[model samples]
Target chain A: MKIAFTAKGTDWDSQMDPRFGRTEYILVYDDEKETFESFDNRDIENEAHGAGPKTSQKLFELGAQVLITGNGPGGNAATVLQKAGVKSFIGAGGMNVKEAYKAYKNNELKEF
Target chain B: MKEIVIISGKGGTGKTSYTASISVLAGKDAIVADCDVDAADMHLLMKPVVEKSENFYSGVVAEIDPDKCTNCGICTEKCRFNAIPVINDQHIISSLNCEGCGYCEKVCPVEAIQMNEMNVGDWYISNTKVDNTMVHARLGIGAENSGKLVAKVKNEAKQLAEETNKHYIIVDGSPGIGCPVVSSLSGANYVVLVTEPSVSGLHDLKRVYELVDKFNLKAGCIINKSDINPEVTNEILDFLKKESIEHIVSLPYNENFTKAMTNGQTIVEYDQGELRDAIVQSWEKVKELVEE
Candidate 1:
């Protein structure tokens, strides 16, 4: 399964983003391939409405089955993720991408 | 026909009361459009008898058929609004959360999802007790498209005015510089901003004026309850003069306004004193400015 993390940067040491829709970057982790890919999300800042749904669409197209972020998406975006059949875990705001991944493995993150 | 919109950036600044009196003063020559769909109160004073009523449809919402039998959860995964939620292992659509985007209907594989038109509100054309036409609307509970509803009321009022050969359409606009307010200002020939001599009132007036300025529309100012705060009132007068906004009138704080409301009579009908004369003069000035 692929996991996505909202992050401040492109690397594993980048701090996790707390916001879902306006996150700076969406970093994807492929468990089977052991590879990481990052998608820039800064362009969503200009969206006046449906920022959540826009970001969720990006996450859905990224083929990420699991989302590990700080605070989860808002109602609209959350609906998108719920429909996309993607599982989301929040409360990873203060942690870096690597720490958030470890916490996800340890079941320390809260299911959103 | 000319359209004149009366708006108060802050609530309880006498927009409705002022509008009621203006309707009475303008009489048969004007038709009133109450665009405050959030909490329509002009009906209380107008006492409109419904002449015609129509259902207002706006946007669309997705509905899921549980009998289709696939718990595959595709609808929930694709819905951007998160309107569909799993309840008792069955996907149910929440009408309130739905934005009527129809994306889920397109993505649903079993064709279980159907998009349905949402009836968000109702608009009415009525004959007021004062014997003039009044166009108003009532938004359904949890409805968010108040701007569309306001536009409906304005368009209907304008059509009614044109049919009846009325010279003006007087609009009672909603508070704040939001969507509904913008809709009210659209195509209006003139704007009458009712304000009080208070800090927040002045602040909101500036914000609302910024919005009006964007539409490049002419505006006049009515300083209601000017005596409540002389210093702030003077400051407001200075701002009006600097902006070249016409000073329509300055009404003092009076309990007669409350009395007139309680009696279900407009200030023009209840008060035959100087207060009534000022309101009548204000209406005349508004008519003259709108005509110009």
Candidate 2:
């Protein structure tokens, strides 16, 4: 299983980015591989509409079974991710990607 | 044919009501286009009978093939929107999240992604209670490219006008100075911006006016509910005078406008008093101005 977290930096220790659609980077962790990968997401800044949906699509493509973020998955975006069978959590805000992942694994975060 | 669009920067300033009344007074010689696809309340007043309806596609989205699976993650890295998420050991693309940038398609190491266009909304051709036809639409929620939809609506209306040999196209436009509003403004011969007598109305009016000025379209103003605040009405008049915006008409506050709507009728059909007269007079003025 793979989990994705919106992040401010391209590393495991990067702070959690609050914005799901406009987050600076997305940090994904593969549980079986025990690997961490990150990608810059600065291109979302020019998106005028459906940013959340596009980002959710990215999560679906990234193989994220669970998503941890500060804000959303807005109403439209939540529907998209829901259809793709991806569950999203909204807690673990202000935590680094690693800490957020730990909280998510512990079931300490709130589902959105 | 002359195209006239009625726009308001703020909502609830009588845009649909006024457009309905103008269509009534303009008779069958006019083609009314309701470009307010965002809310689309003009149909409520005009009570159009459906003549034709069709789906509209604004843009294409990227789709992924899980069969040719190489988990190289190049598409994920190439996507700026973070739209590629892998699920259940199979990687897929979110059509909703895909901006259709086509960057991922080029970078996909295994040639997994393909771009596809999908229907995002519906457009309609309907016969109205006023003996004319209306071209309107309903944009799908989460639909992108509303500007393109607006253009489609206007183009249909213009085509209808030519087919019927109608000399007028009265467009009830969407609020704000966004892409839809800009789309409605394009190729229009006249723009009537409806605003009310309120602080926020004036502020939004200034914004809408700036857009009109930018386009350099021939413009006018209709101050609806002008009696609600005498001070604001005076200020609006003064501002228009200074800015050289034609004061098309100032309509007094009347519950009859709301009552007319509740009965599913335009004020011209429902009432005989001041509000109806004011709208009729405004339409006449618009016609004279257009003829000039």
Could you give candidate 2's per-residue lDDT for residues A1-112 as a string of tens digits?
Answer: 8888998788888877655765678888889999989878767644545566888889899989888887545556788899888898875555888889888878888787
Give the worst 10-residue stretch by lDDT in candidate 1 chain B: B143-152
Best by TM-score: 1
Candidate 1, residue B228: lDDT: 100
Stretches of candidate 2 off by over 4 Å are: A1-112
Q: Can you give the lDDT of residue B64 in candidate 1?
A: 86
* Regions of model 1 farther than 4 Å from truth: A1-112
**What interface-residue Cα RMSD does candidate 2 give after superposition?**
14.8
Native contacts matched by each model: 0.00, 0.00
lDDT of candidate 2 over B196-271, digit per residue (tens) = 9999999999998887775556789999999899999999999999989899999988899999999999999999
Lowest-scoring 10 consecutive residues by lDDT in candidate 2 chain B? Answer: B139-148
Number of clashing pairs per prediction, in order: 6, 19
